[model samples]
Target: MNALSIRSIHGRQIFDSRGMPTVEAEIVLHNGVRASASVPSGASTGRFEACELRDNLAEYHGKGVSSAVNHINTPIQEALVGESCDDQWTLDNKLMVLDGTQNKSKIGANAILAVSLACAKAAAKAYGLELFRYLGGLQANTLPIPMMNILNGGAHAGNNLEIQEFMIVPVGAHSFTEAMKMGTEIYASLRNCLKKKGLSTGIGDEGGYAPDLNGDEEALSLLMEAIQLAGYQPNYDVKIALDAAANEWYKNGHYIFPKLQKKITQSELKGYWEELCQKYPIYSIEDPFAEEDFPGFSELTASLGGSVQIVGDDLFVTNPDRLRQGISSLSGNAVLIKPNQIGTLTETLSTIRLAKEHGYGVILSHRSGETEDTTIADLSVAVNAGQIKTGAPARSERVCKYNRLLKIESLISGSEYPKK
Candidate 1:
């Protein structure tokens, strides 16, 4: 292994035809190996209105998007200037150390995560191995799970009901075309089912729900029908999950926990959940209520214990203090791990370990405003997370992560490893 000299680090603003900002980071290796990662800056026009937080940390800190891009480029390039490519761990550790002291509060967690992902990609290419195999051991096969996203109701309720909910069907076959065909079939079935109920077929960023299908039992029932029609068999490899993203709506005196408790009667909520578990075999639910509702979380956990996972994202916010409280109180059974929430890979992994040890499932996730950085893909395999929740495999940015996972699976196809 030759010494790895950081050639140059650069950033550029790429946009979809709609003029949305997708920031790309490029790191050139001394051996002429150039690797890049991109993420949506969440600063695009008309995007913020659809989300809960008007400004992610980039806006909160008053730093421009370029600041984060530069944070990743500068220190990482300097740290790896004369390091060996094979010393990936050592290099990553060194960068983590610098980030801890110098850039602690500058650009927030996104910078460190972006840098780590770029380095991981470069290292994977150097070894001619897929990123996951390089991070985690091989598995007999990759399993596909159903994915659902919180599109409306509560905080993300914009007038336009793009398809906010999603079901991810992982097609690990060698042929991308075949995988896409399967996805299309599943989507068509779901759409037909929704249409039969006179509901909208679009979800996530595609289509909105009907005005009458507000966040109630009726809406959920329609969703259940659509999922079943999509040929999804609950619990037998077809697991169901929901991303509430409810915290976004609680900013201005909305008080989600109490409202959820009041709006959704316990019996009704429990009945719907029971039906979901029995019908679709849902395995996980994220942010069922507002972030601060610890008591409500405990009640839900106690009620639905061992039946499914209750995941916390906005509640924990990557803060160790909150995680400790959640664990002690039995608030939820899982934590959604997003490195950018805490700003460093070291801390993120530490949280994952802590959660696992405390008897909680770890789920690696991507933000709605995401980049092409595939770090979460590797981290999911590395940490053996219970699952990974990126958006549906529709857009290129979202599919890019899934595509990388497929490559990882290919590299370790025949290896005997325990399921993660």
Candidate 2:
């Protein structure tokens, strides 16, 4: 028997950062090496995302993951035990075939992803290689630029603001550590700015300040003030990014801004975004239109793709097919890669590779309802994705990814931070 062969698999239900139950799986190799991984949940999920199964019982408010845990501990365990853990594609394919569902609805994406990640962790341990090195080979030495979210709105918070997230990107940093310094300083300065204005400094699901400001532009103004107070030059040392999550408020052929009390056509919204980008140091805008509006995304990309990074989160959901369509249509210039969005490490890497092959920028990301899993941090480096969006530096669940990236930077002999 191969020493790297899987010996057994076990799964259990664990609570995520949102105190919601999620699936965690452990894998033991024949050589006695063991590893485990946990899956995250997403609050602003896409319609095309793979299914995350849960029990409908009263426990955990019908969010209990006992059914997913049972699937991992039983059917997946039976199908994967005694199998070779060397080939990730083969193993991931097996999981997909076992489920025999396009969206992983039968066995649950959460459960399949837990086992899939655990196998990778166990294989890396058995081979005495770091997870990034194991998955990406020796060429995996590029640290991603951190896109830190500092302000929040939309579904992520109870605020009336229409935007979902307002992020700061440290494009001028020479290294990942310097990027973290710039991001954290601005975050602190923003907190102080809000406190002085008597606005709530309370954080949202992704640890960004969810202050009830006067309007969406006010949020941008506060961010600019914070950036200047932090002693960083806007558009030079740092830049702004937004996750509009426009699909949340998109009504029949129009975008609704409740705080602004305006219902405007898609073209009007596009013009508004153009005005903001011209007025601010904005470098990236994600999901500027609804998920279904590929034509709108394409038009925006054509207009702003030369300067601004147009990212697709809900539009792609890290799905390769959707990305291919976007690439063909020139929908957006970038993709937001969330592992849970696709439900497996192999599929996630495939999407990253596909996006890069098409000249699209890749931003590996964390879900709003995340866990302590640092797989995405390694994944970003493993693929040299060049950018990451892992929330603010406040919550431990979000900070854990940054901490792991810092550790990875220390371990690499000649790590490089991506150039702007």
Candidate 3:
């Protein structure tokens, strides 16, 4: 029953896509197997989520994470070395206590999450189990539906559009592979569609084209055209999803659409989404209000919850307490899970379980700024979340998760996805 004990751990500062320094942690076992994991940074972060440590000095323009790296290398490493890496909870608990804060403020979520995930990788490797199996046991068999974001706006894009992400969901596909094919085809058609319109193909943070469009309706029009161009029926073969990420552009107390050159109140925002649902084949809306606007979420969900998904990203941030509060307020019907937002694999899994137990849908998501780590792919499968949002089918970092899912689908040949 015994194998290799965790021998050592270390961390260092690394650069993320935005040329900002982030944390990367390495864990080594006694038998020489080693694993290293890096945390992804988010461009549009929630106000309530765990803090991502940054040096306020001139270096990296106040985005440096040398403090986090040092935290991992010294006290955290000293406490974690010689512990069983397989005891993910115990390890994460140590991290929680060491930080001794609600949001991991003392040590930094960036440092703790990197070490937590790195130890998970090392444990799985040392135990000779695939990461999914290691985390989910035998029930980790189903593949998730891909939510491919093909258009970018708001904080994630340089364009003036208010909505942050415009995605295509291939929900009608029978299998994960087929669903991925549908998304890729639509993505390609969208590229050609942009070219025909004399629009630039320069992509945003998540690899979707960031064109200067006037409003959200233009995005819906382009997506429908792309689906038709790819030989698929709108709302049948593919459905539209929007991540408004409204908190990013929420100024003072009003939601502003610079592209539309207008500002809207809570009732007006609700009317706008209702109109969108009527005009387009929209299936989901994320962060339709600011993080603190629970009543807005409740009213919108009550009116539209019967028809489509109302997801909370900034509203929940994958925190159990926030999710619990959301459940009480009827804030959202679904939640977006980002591990870094909560700061540990154990906490992330707990949050997912909590959301699912309450009949809320779970959307495993990727950060706007990311690395080549594909752990989120395995975690998605491990938890059997029916949906995942890992950006578009461009860039090596974004595509790596999709490619890992492809390989995983190959491994379980006789399995049927879409879970009964």
RMSD of each: 5.9, 1.0, 1.5
Error of 2 at 362 (Å): 0.5
lDDT of 1 by residue, 1-420 (tens): 353555666765455312345456666777888777654432111111111111245543433355556665576566666666455567657765765643345433445555556666776677776666665545424323314342334333443322123343332323333444444455565557667767654544422233335444444555455545666543442344565554543445443233334344434544555565576545666766567777767877887768778888877865566789999999999887766566545567678879978988777776666666777876777666636676655566567766776665555545222231
Using lDDT, rank the candidates from best to worst: 2, 3, 1
Q: Looking at candidate 2, what is the lDDT of residue 383? A: 94
Candidate 1 regions exceeding 4 Å error are 15-19, 40-64, 72-76, 84-103, 138-146, 150-184, 196-199, 206-214, 231-239, 249-281, 318-321, 415-420
Worst 10 residues of 2 by lDDT: 252-261
- Residue 94 error, candidate 3, Å: 0.4
Model 2 TM-score is: 0.98
Best-fitting candidate, scored by TM-score: 2
Tell me how far the alpha carbon of residue 410 in candidate 2 is from the true structure, in angstroms, after superposition.
Answer: 0.6
> What TM-score, over all chains together, does every model reach?
0.74, 0.98, 0.97
lDDT of 3 by residue, 1-420 (tens): 134667888898888766678889999888888999999999889999998988888978988888999899899988988888999999999999999999898899999999999999999998899898899888888898999989999888988778899999997898888988999999999999999999878999999989987577888899999999999999877899999988875788788775665888889989999999999988999999999899999999999998889999999998999999999999889999999999999999999999999999998999999888898999989998888999999988899999999898887656457731
Could you give candidate 2's per-residue lDDT for residues 280-363 as a string of tens digits?
999999999989999999999999999999999999999999999999999999999988888888999899999989999999
Best by lDDT: 2
Backbone clashes, each candidate = 18, 0, 0
Model 3 has an lDDT value of: 0.90
RMSD of 1: 5.9
